[model samples]
Target: MSLFVDSSSIRNFLRRDWERAESQLGSVLSDTMVKLGAVLNELANILDGDSAAKYLPLVGDLRKVKRFINAILLMQIEKTNLGRTDFDKRDLINLMLLHLNYPGLFRRIRNLFAVEPA
Candidate 1:
């Protein structure tokens, strides 16, 4: 006799499998820190007054954002050294969503990274 699995059961199984896969991928904190570092570096390259003027209105004050990013990076480093995994996953997710929704900003960041230093 063959046992039939219901749709809900299959969905639950798939969800659990996905969670397991995510867990095996390692800490989300580290991934977010790396992404933030890339963004920060791109920002640093474009932070001169004239270059930052256009972006400031879209992203708020560039200086404040820079400080915030640095703080997050430092906190992540400390947590890692302490063997801690706790972090605000929502903040990282929201930051990613913000980037995704703002194509212009994302393009600017991508362009900055693409340019070769003279």
Candidate 2:
């Protein structure tokens, strides 16, 4: 589904998406920013990893970022510290931040596993 074809294209894609992710200000729900699709896609893409909750694109809400970080980053990476990860959702009061990963990871995964590109 991505447009990446080679090293050059991969760099271009990362630069473009990474810039877009950086320029973004994590303003909570500015109309369509809080939708399920937006949240899920952003998570799936792992955009702006390591950004604080209030700085991620559509995940600035301190009330809805826990599940993703817990399920994706904290769980996927097997962190030893259980409750001290990003997206500080202390006492059922917060949720935010994307997982840590470079933008080029997508292309690398595709290159390693994709088959029969049409």
Candidate 3:
């Protein structure tokens, strides 16, 4: 339900339908990134020497999420070499990304394909 709203907002943005989709994703990724920063900062303060080593994966995951969000935004507006008719998935970090740009019946079909795990 909520994901459909998100995808529609993003599509509106890419199609230059800005007035209504202005807030689009509503800073969801930005908010997540900020929390990641806070976690990293806290880890830095409490971790040191040998104990700090184990927290590396957590930090890495945070960074990956931050990058993933940025990548999605960037790719949303990009056109493939085939022209403005299609979007390329080779560079998209999330499979859900490609689904958003498709139109009409395809878009609905894509929604089903990109469904999140239950």
**Which candidate should be chosen as best, given TM-score against the real structure?**
1
User: TM-scores of all models?
Assistant: 0.28, 0.20, 0.20
Q: Tens digits of per-residue lDDT for model 2 on 1-118?
A: 5322333333233334433543385533333322322334444344334433333433333223334433333333332333475542231122222222232664565567868869
**What are the lDDT scores of the predictions, listed in order?**
0.45, 0.36, 0.38
Instruction: Give model 1's clash tally.
Output: 0
TM-score of 1: 0.28
Better of 1 and 3 by lDDT: 1
Of the pair 1 and 2, which is ahead by TM-score?
1
| lDDT tens digits by residue: candidate 3, 42-81 | 3334234364344333222333334434544454422233
List the candidate 1 regions with Cα displacement exceeding 4 Å: 1-28, 62-118
Q: For model 1, how does the per-residue alpha-carbon lDDT over 5-62 read when each residue is reduced to its tens digit? A: 3333323432244335435866545565455544444444443335454444433433
Ranking by lDDT, best first? 1, 3, 2
Estimate the lDDT of model 2.
Answer: 0.36
